[model samples]
Target: MKLHFKIEAEKATSDIDVTIDNLVVAGWAGRDHAAIEHHIEELAALGVPRPSAVPLFYRVSESLALQGQRIQVVGAETSGEVETFVFSAGGILYVSLASDHTDRKLETTGVALSKQICAKPIAATAWPFAEVADHWDSLIIRAYIVEGGSKVLYQEGPLSSLRTPQELISGYTDGAAKLPDGTGMICGTVGAIGGIRPSSNFTLELHDPILNRSIHHSYAIEVLPEVA
Candidate 1:
């Protein structure tokens, strides 16, 4: 399964191009679930999945991956809310106004998606300078890597507001925020025809909407399917 997504802008409007390369998998007799799931995950190459025999979608939101343009401008130079973009694991898109800013760099942070585990943060190197100067309203703030296992994690943030870096890094509670939890049914029996299966060596990637490029980091994670 090949899953490729590319977002770009032309004529001042953003465009999203998504492609899912569907492939067929042969289920052999006596093969365990791990072996099959491993091969299946490879099909999508990772994040993207084929809707064969099973149904799944990565979360997304307008604030995550979608383009950010002013919903309504109050007055020029008044500094309206900053639009943020996000890609939820559920395949939904988020595009809206809200931000975590600071007077300094590497000194601010977004709220954790959840307390169960600390989500990885990748602040935009081009932020404030590239994104802000270029007027790119949205940018990716964090990325996370979780052990695969037919699970779900809920994210709560993009609080539809703005605050100082000091407040966000310190976990301020006055504004809207994303509080996520990953949960899901593990593996079903071999005869199961439909279910979400976790992946080995799970990896996460984040992008800067304004810069239109991936952040300078990637997180490769290994969890679940423990071996002795």
Candidate 2:
């Protein structure tokens, strides 16, 4: 399926000349190099192995990515917040919010398989990279999980919590493979408050207070019937 996104360009120009083939997720991309252990400890509780190094890379099936208001999963134990970067074929950059929705059960067996088993949800709205480049560190990302008919803060932090986009892109590419046009990368995320847990509905946003604009996306998780 071709994923189309609304571009908020710096200038009043309409452009839609990009196709995405590679969708990559950069994990352990945090700036607090020392805190990586803490984040690892958090996931290790769920049987996820500690990464061999920082900035671990994983490729999810671009065919499984979704941007609508609702997404269906077989069995997802929890979701995490992340800032998504979209690279245009022209080298222009855009940013949005997304949830690396993962199945905790499968994660224990294999991280890549767990990531693939669930559809990656992203926001339809995106902001031009130039708009917030000067104050990129000030950008904030927050998420809430609907629990017992009320929304509770699941994760919250600034974009600076993780490695900058430049660093992550460089690490992922290693100066070898340039991020091709229409490449979409879901950058790593911060820790979850109150510990990671499951929820039926998940909402998230990428807020740039400097520009006074934000990209928001929310989706409900519907479990499919299991053959017993």
lDDT of candidate 1 at residue 39, scale 0 to 100: 36
Query: How many angstroms is residue 186 displaced in model 1 relative to the true structure, after the best TM-score fit?
Result: 26
Give per-residue CA lDDT, model 1, range 1-228, as digits (tens). 111223323323333333212111112111244544643553334233333442111222212221122122111111111123222223433222222111111112211111112122212221222223233224333322233544322111121122222223123223434312111100111211122222221222234554555433222222323245
Q: lDDT per prediction?
A: 0.24, 0.76
The best candidate by lDDT is 2
Off by over 4 Å in 2: 10-17, 176-178
Error of 2 at 84 (Å): 2.6
